[model samples]
Structure formats: C-alpha cells, structure tokens
Target: MNPEIIGQYLPLYGEAAILTVELGFLGVLFSAVVGLFCAAVLYLRVPILRQIVWIYIELSRNTPLLIQLFFIYYGLPKVGIRTTPAVCGVAGLTFLGGSYMAEAFRSGLEAVPKIQEESALSLGMTKAQAIRLVILPQAFSVSVPALVANVIFLLKETSVFSAVSLMDLMFTAKNLIGLYYDTTEALFLLVVFYLIILLPVGVLGTVLEKRVRYAGFGS
Candidate 1:
C-alpha cells in the first residue's frame, strides 16, 4: 500500500495488462470462428457432421477447463503433439467457449421462422443461397447478444493460461507478489489489472445487446 512501491510497480503492471488484453482478444476470436462453424453444422442438419458436432460439443462443454489445459499442456506431447503454452491456452479457451456458444447459435437458428425457408424455396433459391441470404442474417442478429456474452466468458477463461505458466497479467501478478513479498499491494494491483482487462468487454456487450435489440429482432 506504500505509494513509493506502487509507483515503482505501475509500469510492470501496465505491461502485464496489455498481455492479458491480447490473450482475451485472441481467445474470443478463435472461439467465435470455431463455434459458429460447428453450430452451423447442427443447424443445417448435415447428416454425419451434425453427429460429429454434437460429440465435440458434449465432450468440450462437459469438461473442466483446468483439466483441459492440463491435458493440452501435458497429454498432447505424449500423443506426439506439441505446442507452446500460449497456443495451448488459446486452444483451451476456444474449445471451452465454442461448446457453449455453439448451443446459443443453434438456439438462435431455431428461433428464425421456418416460413422464411419455405418462402426462399418457392423462389427457387438453392439451400446455400437461401440460408446465406435469408437465414444467417436473421439468425446472427438474434444471436449477437449471446455471442457477446460468450466472448466475455472467453476473456475470463484466459486466466487458465497463468496456471500453465504463461506470462499473462495474472502470471505477472503472481511473480510480482513473490518478488515483492507484499500480498495486499500485489493482489490489489492484480485486481485492477483484471478490471482494466475485462470491464470494456462488459460495456461492449451492453452496446452490442442494444444494437441487436434495435435491429428489429425480439420485436
């Protein structure tokens, strides 16, 4: 709590916060790409792909992320796969967020009226054309809020990277505490770091939700 110690520590904490922001940004993007594709498989009623998507979702959604990260860090090498801790952290966050977000997309897809599909069919639109032109726009509009929430969750989930020895904000905080031997100041600074990393995502989510509501969805 000493002003001098905090003054000395501020620069390091700032750098660590930047790293945490990068991790959250990358993790959310990875999850959205993977989750949207998988969710589309189920929504489109792709025969074998639907089954595979379900299996993937169930396996990932049911497992704890810490265990998943451990497996990625430890078990991957045993099975002849190797990736850096940062890579594994991204993969872990992607799988964790993708499973949950896919379900949200699936639900949103179901919310879009089937009449729209029939209308497109009567106009001789191909399946892909109908889905792309008529369906996904509405589906995504409906799902935007949920997607934002999932992104926020993904951001928080990146904390697991610290457990695997990644030098994210949290890992830096732990090191600072150990090096400085001041638990209260180190932890207070870390909490500030987390808030700086995470609060904007919350504000962004609210803005996105408002945008979605104004888009003629949930009317």
Candidate 2:
C-alpha cells in the first residue's frame, strides 16, 4: 500500500534473497555429495558403513527438520562445538536433504540392470571400474528427476533456517513486517521474490526430466 515503505526496504530484501540463494546452493551441493556417498555405500553393501547409512537416513527422514536445526545450532554449543548460524543452518539442510536424496539415489542405483555390470565385466573391467564406467552413469540418469525435485524442495525448506538467525528471504520478510507493520506488502514481496527464484529452477527441472526421458540412459 505504501510505496515509500516498500522501496525503503527493497535493498535489504534483495540482500536477503541473495543470501537465501547462497544458502540453498551450498546446502544442495553438500547434500548431493553426501547423498551420493551414502547411496554408493548402501548399494555396494559395505559392511558397517551400510548400516550406519541406513540409520542416518531413517533418523533424518523420520525427525522434524526444525529439531535437527536446533540440535546443530543449539545443542552443539553445549558439547563445546560452536559454529555460526550460517554454518549450522547449512549443515542442518545438508543432512536433512541428504537423507531423502540418499533414498532416491539408492533406488536409481538399484534400477540399473545387472546385465549392464556383467557386460562391463565381460569387457575385463574390475567391479569398481564397471560401476564407475557403466552403472553410475545410467543410475545418475534414472535419478536426475528425483534429485532435482528434492533440491527444489530443499530450496524452499531453507526458510526454516530463519529460526537460527540466518538472514534468508523469509527472515528478511518477517523483519520487514516487524519494522514497518505492513504485513500485506511485505508478504507480497516475499512471495514475488521466491517465485522469481523458484520458477526458473522448476522449469530447469522439467527440462531435465524431459531430456533424460527422451535421451534415455545411452545419452
């Protein structure tokens, strides 16, 4: 309703939006790496590590993300491990998103045909070589849609980081509301900024899904 009020906070809102993107990007990257590692361990049936991975997936998937964030930001301080709000927020997102991603990747790895590995073996490749050269590529293709979707979901989930004082978009919006007492304008801006960020990501995901579908594993 008030143009001056909205304009006054636009710069800060922009900064918060940028910070949100940075956190989401970092969170998704770390989570993807951890998820892939966990998936590989479980797929290969690694002795003790597989069980540990399973437990982590189960616990993380079952628990509330808010509690997980609290433990990282609050509980760790009690254990003599102190980190910044950003670090704890990123770590929390990584672990929480990684657990869901692990399942998607594991299913992808399992979907790879056994004969594909056999064919690689027939070519005189070692098991590791076969997996690296033949299986993972196909598995990655199979999992792309799911992985992308999960990343999108995790990006939205970054809002929860506000609880830890990370100045993400949602936090910035709330701060604006507190300062200006203009809930409608602040909330509208919040939705608009999020749409700007997430719309492109969603489109990219759809494009990736179609490309993977049409190209098939051979591509």
Global Cα lDDT for candidate 2: 0.89
Please give the CA lDDT of all the candidate structures: 0.82, 0.89
Name model 2 segments beyond 4 Å from true: 214-219
lDDT winner: 2
Model 1 lDDT per residue over 151-172, tens place: 7777777767888898877787
Tens digit per residue, CA lDDT, model 2, 1-219: 778877877888899989999989999999999999999999999999999999999988999878999999899999999999989988999989998889889988998888889999999999999999888878877898889889889999988889999899899888878987899889988888889889999999888877766324353
TM-score of each: 0.92, 0.95
How many pairs of residues collide in each model?
0, 0
